[model samples]
Target: MEKIPILRMGDFLLVTIQIDMHDQLALKLQDDLSNAIQQHASKGVLIDISTLEMVDSFIGRMVADISGMGRILGAQTILVGMQPAVAITLVELGLSLPGVATALNVERGMEILRRKIAADGTDERPG
Candidate 1:
């Protein structure tokens, strides 16, 4: 199984998650990404989950955890490319995320991150 990948696109780390119907990968993804986000603190993240058919309770919690952790690490985390069905389901599940912005697409998320980084005067590549 391929590990869930998070790609660095300009200032925002764009991630596209692929999960099977069985929902086996969510836990590992959370643990790995929690560590990865902590390691790359101060870098914004944009997650794309449009491909995901559904987001269960466990995965939703993990995502919410990442959002909070990203803030603590001085990074702005955003969710993009979420299908309407997934979005509605997440809302109904009472999944809550703190400090995580949602965008319609990767480009919008990246734009927001750019403005954020520019305002903070931080270079995307770091020193």
Candidate 2:
């Protein structure tokens, strides 16, 4: 399979993690995120969950893995647009995301990333 796609929006590296409901995408996640952080030098990461139908234990483990790897890669991972039902199911299935950063949506996630960048004095808004 091809490497997962990761895009950059401001200081956030937007990761649209690709995976089947029952498959393992963790190693690919690590590789793709490694490329993203290296390529863009971003301060944060966002996983768009609006496209996911179900997140199982394996995926949850992947999320935790990505979060830890992201920290070492110099980016904090965040989950965005996670459907409440999916979130509930993940929790009910005993899957925790291991302190990965999370946001209600991509916009919020970008804001968080921007805040982090700004805290580091990198604010350069286009006029």
Candidate 3:
């Protein structure tokens, strides 16, 4: 099973999804992300889904779950690089990802995360 690499970036965790993940891999990513959030005490999470060509209901739900988990762990989640068609399909499939925040690209997402963390005044990352 291939694992998604979660990178620690200052006060955030970055996850770039490049491949079409299977169920197991997705589940593993959720677990790993949660653990990383707790271990790092990250202030935010940025997930880049640019290379993901398709997103079914399950994957969409997983993304939402990740966002919710991040919230519970005192981190904000911003999903980026979602293609227009993918967004439409997700909405059509009834997976609007209610609790998740989104940005057009990674750069924008990073900016959003930085601003959020700054406003919150709680930098969870250890020096």
Candidate 4:
């Protein structure tokens, strides 16, 4: 089975989805990310899906679920780099991806996460 790499950066977890997603891979990501957030006490999650040109209902739901799960585990989730068509397809499919915050790119996503962490007074990084 293939796996998506989740990198830990300070109080955040970054996930770049560089491959086509399947049911199993999505499930694994959800499980791995849940564990990682708890293990690292991460404050945020940034997921970049720029490489994916398309999305189905399952994938959309998975993304939404990941965001919701992160929130439940005390982490803010930001999705970034979504292609225009992919977004349209998701809306057309009626998968609005509720509760998931999005940004145009990784940089913007990271900024959003940073602001969120700072506002929450959870910035534990050393200066």
Candidate with top lDDT is: 3
Per-residue CA lDDT of candidate 2, range 4-73, in tens? 6777776677777545533434566667787878788877888887878888877777778778877887
lDDT, model 2, position 46: 86
True-vs-predicted CA distance for residue 46, candidate 2, Å: 1.0
Error of 4 at 29 (Å): 0.7
TM-score of each: 0.78, 0.81, 0.93, 0.92
Off by over 4 Å in 4: 122-127
Candidate 2 runs further than 4 Å off: 18-26, 121-127
Give the C-alpha lDDT of model 1: 0.73
lDDT of 1 at 93: 83
lDDT of each: 0.73, 0.76, 0.92, 0.90
**Model 3, range 1-104, lDDT digits (tens) per residue?**
59999999988999999998999999999999999999999989999999899999889889999999999998999999999889898889888787889999
Q: Would you give me the overall lDDT of model 3?
A: 0.92
Candidate ranking under TM-score, highest first, comes to 3, 4, 2, 1
Q: Residues 12-123, candidate 1, lDDT per residue (tens digit)?
A: 5666887663455666676666677666554787778878888878777767877877777777888888788887887888875545688888788888888877877855
Instruction: Give the lowest summed-lDDT range of ten residues in model 4.
Output: 118-127
